[model samples]
Target: MKTNRLKKSLLGITLSVSLFVSISIMGAPQAAHAATANTTTTAASTSVSGKAGSIIALGKNYLGVRYNFGAQKGVTSSFDCSSFTQYVYGKNGISLPRSSQAQSQVGSYVPRNQLQPGDLVFFYSPIHHVGIYIGNGKIMHTYGSPGVTISDMNSGWWSTHYKTARRVIK
Candidate 1:
């Protein structure tokens, strides 16, 4: 009985050591890879967000510039929604098309819930207007009275007019 008990005890210890060794060898690399992957993802997101901030900052410089229905591109005195986005993004080395409809087709389509700052948000059923999302559900855009101003995207007129969003930076 004593010898059998001793053998069982030895077997249990051997199994435990084997498990520990396997986990230490195999699990270590996987854990390390996961950590590295997480770091890479965070870094990429930070870089993208930083670019977004720069774009937003540039756009805000033209606040109250005045809105024009057919405002020419590269004009700073007055801007239509599409021209404002094109000019601001162009200044940051990101080229956007001349019109809002054309601009919408250039970037990756991003859902409203996944919108980030600097995203080009479009409105109207067939897509007529565009704005740059400035986070907190607000967009910086040019309209009738508030040219190059920030407005909430989640309430009032904007809420019902929400159409789609696009990510041009990434």
Candidate 2:
């Protein structure tokens, strides 16, 4: 009888330990998955910001370039609004459609207040113009007269004509 009780006790102890280990093993992958997802998100955000900075830097290199209504692609001498965005973003591995209307349809929509650098901001009712948000309420784009320039988005024609914005990064 004593031997039987000892065997029962040992069996119970072994079952308990097995259950605990099973639970721990099952939970480990879920915890690791959560941690991995968080790390990936952070890394992706950092990479997007870096790319945005590079695109803006490249755009700035053409700050005063002439504007042509139907500017030729791959030609840097003059740029229409969409051409400017296409050229700059293309240089950094992001491809934008040739027309502002088409570019607006590519990325996810972003609220006006949540605009970030490198976001494509559009103007006009049907989206006639496109610009690169350069932070601080300013956008870099090419237009009549000044050609390529930075304009305030808060209080001017830009503000009134603001239609929508899109985020292409990530």
Candidate 3:
């Protein structure tokens, strides 16, 4: 009886520690998100709700950050194309593979017309690039010249180079 009681006590302690760690990790992002937020209505605030608002809201904060090739994951210092998308979505509790090509395989395909906010958009010949669709036929991404910013999805090179779109949020 004593041995069984001790085991139960240990299990209880273990669970408490686990829950504490989880809460700590999760709370950090919520705090940062709330800190940076203004009155913007993200995909999370529209007719749909989930990770979109939180994801886009955070992505907006990175605007004007210069592009860096092969940026290390989790580093907000500078971001590459895939790293930008990965970081934004990752904050919302969604894990994506490191590369744009690999990240493309994680979500379900959606036609361009059906894309809503929080949708992942792919581009280029071999699908080596990606961005988050923020509705209104625009995408927020980092590449070449400008860092994190929005672009017209139907304008110029994007329209001709668009490959596919994926719905990562549901």
Worst 10 residues of 1 by lDDT: 37-46
By summed lDDT, the worst window of 10 consecutive residues in model 3 runs over 39-48
- State each model's C-alpha RMSD to the native: 22.7, 22.1, 10.4
Tens digit of per-residue lDDT, candidate 1, span 131-157 = 998877878899998788988899999
For candidate 3, what is the total of clashing residue pairs?
Answer: 1
| Higher-scoring candidate on lDDT, 1 or 3 | 3
Candidate 2's clash total is 0
What value does the lDDT take at residue 141 in candidate 1? Answer: 92
Per-residue C-alpha lDDT of model 2 across residues 1-170, encoded as one tens digit per residue: 99999999999999889778756754554344334322212212332236676676667667798999999997777899999999888876898889999999998999999987889999999889999987778888999999999888888899999999999987
TM-score of 2: 0.71
The lDDT-based order of candidates, best leading, equals: 3, 2, 1
Q: Which stretches of candidate 1 lie over 4 Å from their true place?
A: 1-49
